[model samples]
Target: MRTQVAIIGAGPAGLLLGQLLHAAGIDNVILEQRSGDYVLSRIRAGVLESGTVRLLDAVGAGARLHAEGLPHDGFDLLFDGARHRIDLAGLSGKHVTVYGQTEVTRDLMELRAGQGALTVYEAEKVALHDFDGDAPYVTYLDRGEQKRLDCDFIAGCDGYHGVSRASVPSRALKTFERVYPFGWLGLLADVPPVSHELIYAGEERGFALCSMRSNSRSRYYLQCALNERVDDWSDERFWAELRRRLDPATAEALVTGPSLEKSLAPLRSFVAEPMRFGRLFLAGDAAHIVPPTGAKGLNLAASDVHYLSEALREHYAERSSAGIDAYSTRALARVWKAERFSWWLTGLMHHFPDHDGFGGRIQQAERAYLISSPAAMTALAENYVGLPF
Candidate 1:
């Protein structure tokens, strides 16, 4: 098989890239080791920055998002038995759309199918070859048959543990990471959220986030020890624990129900430097990861796609390698800024196991100052709404 670009992974990053490339008259094929249904089944965070929403619109995947996605002008930060609102729109002239990542992927997938794009699901044992040279290709097993795909370039959107980043020789890649001591135990239910706007609660007990997929579906999370097991916590126990971390009035308004899904996600910030390696480029989770506190995961991926698609378009249309040569630098600049924000928010919101008395007081003081000072709130709001892409 031959194409202009061979994309690994059919997740949002890969799918979005394919759409943008196709729209620009570039031919690309997406290969995924998982089935389409399996891709849609994975639950993920979905706070869409204004820029991400614009990309979806450009690819004709924003219709359902605009109709059903909830737009929030601000969110409440609860700490020290008080809740303060950060005016994202007023402070930053931008707001975020609350939509599930699964929904975004589904939209992009359906759009790609309607456009007659090729996405080879269940393409097992996928491998890249000669990406560091002038010619690059991919090989994989399809229904027990080996197949090779030749392409002008390769996009590794398969994620952190995927083959793209792993394909790079260890000496060629430099990695940075911070794995938090705690994880988030999250529950998804059909019940309505306690409030229309999301609430981030930082309490003596732990950190808790009240988010939603829709008016009828709510997703909630609690800070948990790394050793905590989902099987050990029933729906009732999860609700009780969440209540303990919320302010009295907010807790009183909480509604509980049977969970649609439950899982524990560890917190971490990671980045693989110089996102490009010859003809092979890494995007999305293949390049970086952020703790969910700042809600930067999917948005960050979208930004990566933005930079990559533009670079590829320039390479094809203008016959220039400048954008491609500069892709890593541009993407990483935004990636590190986001990493810092997510790390800072995670530290401020979650209880550390070994925080000394003085450290706790300092954290408290910072939180108090953030609410009272417009400058601090403005900085939070700007980052929360997203920095310019």
Candidate 2:
């Protein structure tokens, strides 16, 4: 097989990159190790930055998102039984949309299929070959037969565990990592959201987030020990903790249903420098990952591919590799800023055993400062709503 770009992984990054390039009259192929159904149904990020929404709309991928996605002008920061609203629109002149990543993937996959883009699913032995040569190739097992795909460039949109990053020389890659002492026990319940806006509650019990995937389905998470096990948490215990953390004075209308899904995601921040080497480039989780506290995971991945697509377009049109060469530095500038914001939000909201009363007071004071100070609030709003791509 021959193409201009061989993309590994059919996640948002790889799939979107192919779509964008295809729109620009570029030829590309996508490879995935999982079935299309599995890729479209994976439980992932749920919040979309305003910039992400605009990008989707511009690319004509927001038809269903515009109709089904929920828009929130602000979010609630709860402490000591009181709620403070950070008016996102007032602070940044923009708002966020609550739509699951699965929906985005499904929409993109449908769009890709309509456009007749080639996507191989459940392909095995996916490996990058001759990435440093003039013609890069991706080899995999399709239908129990070995196949080699040749392309001018390769994109590693696969997750952190994929072979895209491993193809790089170990000595040339610089990795930075920080693993938190806690994780989040996330649950998806078939219930209506308690509040219209996302609620970040910091209580004496723990940290809880009230977010929605749709009008009829809600998603919530609670801070827990890093070593926590899903088998250890029961449905009753989960709901009780959620209630204690999101304790509201007034009895709001809420319908509790069985948790359809439950899992624990360990909090961590990881970044690998130089997202490109030779003819191969990395985008999204393949290159970096952030804690979900700031809700920047999916948006960041989309942003990475946006720049990469632009660079590839420039390379094809102007025969200039300048944009592609600077891809890493340009993308990392935003990556580190988000990393700091996610770290700050995670540290401020989550309760740690080592934090004494003094520490608790400090966190409360920080929260107070963020709410009362316009400058701080504006900074938070900018990071939370997302930066321009």
Candidate 3:
């Protein structure tokens, strides 16, 4: 098979990149190791930054999102049992939309199906071949048969564990990573959200987040030991922790439903230098990953595709590789900025047991300063809400 771009992985990054390139009359193929059902049903990031929303809207992918997603003007920062609302709208004139990653994947999958784009799922041994050479290929096993796909370029939109990053030479790539001492045990419930806005709680026990997926369903998370097991947490135990973190003032009827899903995500900060190497380019989690505290994962993936798509479009239009050549440096600038923000947010909200009283005091002072100073607040709001691509 041949295409202008052979994209590895059918995640949001690859799907959106294909869509953007398709609109610009570029040919691309997406390969995935999982079935379409698994890809669409995977529980992932829910929050979408303003820039992401606009990009989806521009591509006609926001119709369902606009109708079904909840828009919040701001979020609440809870500390010492006090709630401080950061007016996202008032601060940046932009708001975030609460729609699950599954929904976005479903929407894009439907769109791609209708268009008859080349998408192969449940493929195995998906490896990038000759990525350092001018003619790079993607070799995978489809239906027990090995297939080789030749393309002008290869995009590694696969997640952290995928083969894209591994294809790069260790000497050429500089890896930076910081793993947190804690992880988040996220839960999806059938109950309505306890609050109107997303609530981020910083307590002595740990950090907690109250977010919504829909009017009837709520998504919540609590910080726990990095090695904690989901089997250790019972339904009653989960609610107890949530109640303590959320601390509902009134006796609102709290109904506990069967947890549709639960998982532990270890917090970490990672970035690989030079997102591009020869004809192979990396995007999304393949290039960088941020702790989920700032809700930047999905948006960061979208931002990468937005920039890469534009670069590829320019390459096709002008028949110049300048845009493609500069892809890594351009994308890394934004990637690092987001990395700092995610790290800062995670450090401020999460209580590290190893940190002493002075460390806690420093975090508190930072949060206080963020809320008090307009410049600091604006910076937070700008990064949280998102910047224009």
Number of backbone-clashing residue pairs for each candidate, in the order shown: 0, 0, 0
Query: What clash pairs does model 3 have?
Result: none
Q: Is candidate 1 or candidate 2 better by TM-score?
A: 1
lDDT per residue as tens, model 3, 1-389: 89999999999888988899999999999999999988877898789998888878776789999999999889988887777888888889899999989999888888888899989999899988887888889899999999999998999999999989998889999999999999999999898887878888888889999888998998889999987999999878998887777556711445567798899999899999989998899999999999999998889899899889988999999988888888888888889899999999899888898998899889989988877888887788888988777
**Of the pair 1 and 2, which is ahead by lDDT?**
1
Candidate 3 global lDDT:
0.88
Predicted structure 3: clash tally: 0
- Candidate 2: which pairs clash? none
Instruction: List, residue by residue over 1-389, the lDDT tens digit for candidate 1.
Output: 99999999999999999999999999999999999999999999989999999999998999999999999999998998988888899988999999999999999999999999999999999999999999999999999999999999999999988999999999999999999999999999999999999999998899999999999999999999999999999999999999998999999999999999999999999999889999999999999999999999999999998999999999999999999999999999999999999988888888998899998998988898888899999999988988898
lDDT of 2 by residue, 234-317 (tens): 988898778878756512454567999999999999999989898999999999999999999889888998889999999999
Q: Lowest lDDT 10-mer window, candidate 3?
A: 246-255
Between the candidate structures 1 and 3, which one is better when assessed by lDDT? 1
Report lDDT per candidate.
0.95, 0.89, 0.88
**Model 1: C-alpha RMSD to truth?**
0.6
